[model samples]
Target: MEKVNLVFGTVYGSAQFVAETLTSKIAELDFETNLIQSSDLTGFVPKEDELLIIVTSTTGQGDLPDDIAPWFAEMKSAAPYLPGLRYSIIGLGDSSYETFCGAAKQFDELFAELGAKPLTARLDIDACETMEPETDAVQWISTWHSAAQSLNQ
Candidate 1:
């Protein structure tokens, strides 16, 4: 069975909740899902057969959550190779900010630069006041799984 890993860097717990809900939905679809905090992804890379879903939130000035700053730095600097890996990103931010979901955007670009293929288009969710991140995440993952299955055929 293919696995889908959910890595989260959340502030104010909203992003974490979003990640968990999405992981649960993926598991319901029969895909193995691993939920990991961004701080704990050291030396971690998804297997070629697995997919990675990064759920990250923007902080002050559109920075990554404090817990995930190190991981972001390492990915940007070391550029650890991930071949044959497919991934996607969901960004949580306030649209009121000049750089909404900027952290997720950066992560998406970094993964692309490192040669990881995106299994789905990135979803940038505005804060809860305007849009529901959880709902968008669920729909996006469903679409991603279907696309991935089709691609594998």
Candidate 2:
């Protein structure tokens, strides 16, 4: 079975919750899924066959959440080539902020810089627009799921 690494970075747990919710949906599509916290990725790198799904929330002044900052910094310093890796991102933020979804945007750029292929466009869930981010994320995942499957063929 294909595998999916559902990685998350959360401030007040919204991103974590969204990641968890997506896990089941991913499984329903017949992909084996693993839930990973961004902070725990010390020497981790996604294998070519593995799909990376990042769900992150921006924090203070458009900064990455504390748990993910170190990992992001490490990746920036290392700049590992990942041309074979495919990934997607879901960002949670309030549009009222000057840098809404900034952390996710940063991740998107970093992944691209490292040569990872994006499975689909990033999903940015605005706190001001929706009370339930998971709903919007779930809807987006259907499209993501299709895109990922196409990669196998």
Candidate 3:
């Protein structure tokens, strides 16, 4: 089975919680999984054939979190060719913010610019709606995985 790499960028830690839940769920699906903060991008890179899942939150009026901004900045500056990457995103933000899920949206665009393909539509969860993050992700992840698996064949 291909490994699943889960990355998160969070200000108040909600994204991390979501990532953990996703990691557990993905493992239950029998995929080897690793959950890490966006800052840990240096630790590993998802191969062209692996699945990448990103969970990020907009911080301080649509900015990346402190721990992740630097890493994302590096990625933007470096802009490594990643035409082979297949990924999905779950962006967490307050709908009240003008830039709801801004960070995640930014990354989604950046990934495309870097030549990565989005395996599915990015899931935008509005915290302002009192949505349950874990529950939403659990359901979405299952559906996303099913879609990815089918496409893989």
Best prediction by lDDT: 2
**lDDT leaderboard ranking:** 2, 3, 1
How does model 1 fare in lDDT?
0.85
**123 Cα displacement, candidate 1 (Å):** 0.4
- Could you estimate the TM-score for every candidate? 0.92, 0.96, 0.93
Task: Flag the better candidate by TM-score, 1 or 2.
Answer: 2
In candidate 3, what are the lDDT values of residues 63-104, reduced to their tens digit?
A: 888777877787788888899898999999888889899899
**Colliding residue pairs in candidate 3:** none
Q: Better model by lDDT, 2 or 3?
A: 2
Candidate 2: list runs displaced more than 4 Å: none
Query: How high a TM-score does candidate 3 get?
Result: 0.93
Residue 47 of candidate 1: its Cα lDDT?
A: 73
Could you tally the backbone clashes for each prediction? 0, 0, 0
Candidate topping TM-score = 2
Scored by CA lDDT, what does every candidate get? 0.85, 0.91, 0.85
Better of 1 and 2 by lDDT: 2
lDDT of 1 by residue, 80-132 (tens): 67768899899999888898999999999899888899888888988846456
In model 3, what is the error at residue 76, expressed in angstroms?
Answer: 0.8
